[model samples]
Target: MKLQQRLIRLSVGVLLLGLILHVALLLGYEQLTYRDRALQDLRGRAQILALNSAAALAFNDTRAATENLQTLRTAPAVVLGCLYAEEATLLAHYSPSGARCPKRPQPAQGAGSIRHVESVMVQDQSVGQLLLEERLPTLAERLPRYGLLLLSVIAAEAVLILVLVVALRRRVLIPVHDLAELAARVTERRDYSQRVSTHGSDEIAALGMAVNRMLCAIEEREAAIKENAHLLQALIDHAPAAITMKTMDGRYLLANQQFAEQLGVSTEAVIGLQDIDLFPTPIAQARDQADRAAAQAEGSLRVEEQLGERVWLSERFPLRNAASEIYAVSAIATDITEQRATQASLAQALANLTQLNETLEARVAQRTFELKQAMDQLVQSEKLAALGSLVAGIAHELNTPVGMVVTTSSTMSERARELKAMVEGGSISRSKLTEFLEDLGAGMSLIENNSLRAGRLINDFKQVAVDQTSMRRRQFDLGALIDDTLHALVPLFKHSGQRIESSIGPQIACDSYPGAIEQIVTNLIQNALLHGLAGRKDGLIELGAHVSHGTVQLTLRDDGKGIETQYLPHIFDPFFTTQLGAGGSGLGLYICHNLARGILGGKIEASNHPLGGATFVLTFPAVAPQRASDAS
Candidate 1:
């Protein structure tokens, strides 16, 4: 603020603070002194009255006590008084204001009112009590007087300060304001030649001289700055790179001659123009994206782009202000079309030579790779063929039960037809009808059994095939499933003088891929009958299951000529079967091994028992690994 204003504010603030404190002290002192004197005066009057009323109270003279209390009228401030007899009876009371005497309660000692209670005694014996109450004067009742006095004092102080402020405004403030005005002019016009007038020999005049000297220095520095800026602008315009400044939204703020020429426009036309207005849609979009990327990155970004026949390598960096915040993007684009063309020519020459040398080697390597891929495809095809053969065997097995069901059902229909004819001809007999129903019941039972057999076979084949194909995990009753599979293979051993004995528990359960286990069992059984018991009679194949250590142990042994000692090690190898000439395909054991290790996530081994038998044991996790839904 101006000197005069600051002086006035300082004076007024000091006066207001002093006045507030003075008024508070005066109010406090008046209340304290007034309350103390009023209390003492009331207590003295109460004591005197108490002494005088002691005689009246002793005699129980109500008239004398009343007369004694009536003297309280002389003290108009006493609102009420009371006299009590020796037995606490009210003998006399007085109220100068015509208000009834308040009940003689305990004296309430506080600032607002004076309550004095003195005991009345005669002959050193308690007689009566006298109470006097007087309301003290409140500050509010004398506010006008104190307020007027405080105002008078503040007014006198304010007048004196005003006179001093006026003098300072003329002697000091005017000169300081002159210096300030000169500084303001220098700042506004940027012409720092003006000097403040030195009107007096004082500190303020000296300050005026200092300000004029500062302006001189500033003027010289500004000239140097202007010259440097001119040189910098010239260098920027002459630079080979096409430099431009643009907002994040792609609007050009400034552009050099080279940048304008690259866009085939003048600098004036380039400024305020967006990329889309100067370039094709694709190029414009690319440029805009680069600008936005630089802004979002809050740092520098580089982009290499092909525009028409030229290649431009542009480096865009964020332009920050005094606050170190990115406000715009500055891009310097260099044309690299000629350089790229030269490099392309060199590359073409080298590629021609390299192609001649690498053609044969590349072809050879590619053929090798192709042949390896073909072999892998062949192996996969063989696996799929084996799976197809298993499906075909299952289909063949299903045909028998389905054919039996069809044949039995047809026979039952014929029997029904015959019975209907006999009834229509009225030649039906009781014995004949009974025999017919019995046949019908047998036929129904046959159909149900066959249908169920077909269903079970289909279900088993489905689960096995699904697990083999996809390796899906599920919970299954191991014993029951094994029994069902054995039953399904009953026809194979029915007339072969062979027995398949199972020593599996009824409650053995597993949470794994049952289909994989089924496949393994089927292959092992076929392998045993085909290899170990090719020509033997009374062949016995034993299968057993037990659970331990979180794994299911399945053991299958055959009582026949055991596997050859030399071939025992390769027993589970693919295409290593001795009966390969008899259409063994050599994949059964290999598939079993893979299913156990990969699908069922387990292991299997083969050994020759000392008792002339080949035994195969497979162990697998009771709980299979979780199935990946997206597994191919």
Candidate 2:
């Protein structure tokens, strides 16, 4: 900008000087041309005067010559005119109306006026001389016009100069100044992004382009440096170990994300903080000593640091400056708390294992005895569960009969009381006596029938417990025994919306454990009632028995929802029940399986009937496998 200002001042001064010289030269040339025109006119007039005066001089007519010279009065500024004889004498002279005329050729002091001399000849003889003086106007008279003209010229040149100066400033000075400013800014601020727009093929433009190239190189280097810094920071932040760098005095200079997290603070907060600011005094002192030692040694030092419940394998190292002097210390910490705990746990577990090995046999024997007791209890529970079902059926079956018997006995007692009252009143008529007798007989019959039904239900249910507890065998008719067992389980289906049907041969008898047979029958019936009959409105339970070859073939089936296909294989598995968490103990079918196979020596298999529903078939020797041990 300063250079541009200097250029403008210098250009203006030179232009003004040139303009002044041009105006002066124009004025001088105009004055010179004016003088020449005046001279030419005066000479022409003098020649004419001399021509006229020649005739006068030849006759010595001075009066006529003077009269001719007076003709100069017709022109302005012809201040003086003279016509003289060639003998160094003035023959005639004329003057303007109020001006003096020079008689001879007077030497002019300057160009303010013009003087010319002429001679006349008559017939090639010198006759006389003619002299004229024309006075030029004074400088004062032309000064205003000159001054106005000069001003006009100067004004035009001023405009031209202004235009040229503006063009130069825009196209040259401004761009140069901008380039200089840009260079200063880039150098001072290290900002290499600014550019100067150079339009023309000039030196300044080339300089701008060179600066742009330099800026490009600088920017590239800056970008590469920033990228490398970012990558280094990223690596430190993502490292698994906690990393930190601190001044030799233990003031933190850098802390990666992991270290910040380990210290339970933000990365920004960790910076500039001494170890004492973040940790307990003892821990901080220990850490600070480690850092100082590492820096003094100019090498790495591995130290184990216990911070609260955590253990860290801290590798403290020194960071050096360009002068190879230790400036800071860095630490990379790997956590080993969990590893140490695991190692201790593994050692303790090995010790416990050795101790257990020494007493394994005794534990096994105790566990075996406990298992035997549990099995016995489980069997007892199963028997109790079957008895529970039997009791439920008996209670249901006996409800109707006991209620009838009570009603009939009450009616009979009421009738006998009425007869006794009539006899005491001595008004018992024959028809009344007959009506009372009839009512009593009908009540007696109802009581007898219902009592017998209740007795039969009780007898059947009582047999259930007897058969389960006593492993007695009998040559009982299979059909009668099944009927009796089915009768016992009748109350279970009475309100269950199921039909219990039986198909048996009358002579089919079994010498097997009746108790086991009873148990198997009760379990199957209970299973059908509880599982197959669940959620069913109407169902059918069919019991079939026969003697085939030397074995008694018994089958029970229900036309209820069958067991699921997936559960069919495990339907009889001990402790596996589809109705788990409900009321089912999962022991009914297992006990049935055990009793049939283990006690009755029978192979009982269950399957889904082709039609639908679950079917169980029991095939046992007609004479049980241990007749002597199970005889009734």
The best candidate by TM-score is 2
Model 2 clash pairs are: 84-91
Number of the predicted model whose lDDT against the real structure is largest? 1
lDDT of 1 by residue, 189-296 (tens): 656567778765555665566556555655565577679878877887899888999986778998988887777878889888899999999988988888888887
Q: Candidate 1, which segments miss by more than 4 Å at Cα?
A: 1-468, 629-632
| TM-scores for all predictions | 0.30, 0.31
lDDT of 1: 0.69
RMSD of each: 35.9, 45.3
- Those runs of model 2 whose alpha carbons end farther than 4 Å from true positions after fitting are 1-172, 187-191, 345-632
Residue pairs in candidate 1 whose N, alpha carbon or C atoms collide under 3 angstroms: none
- Model 1, 347: alpha-carbon shift in Å? 88
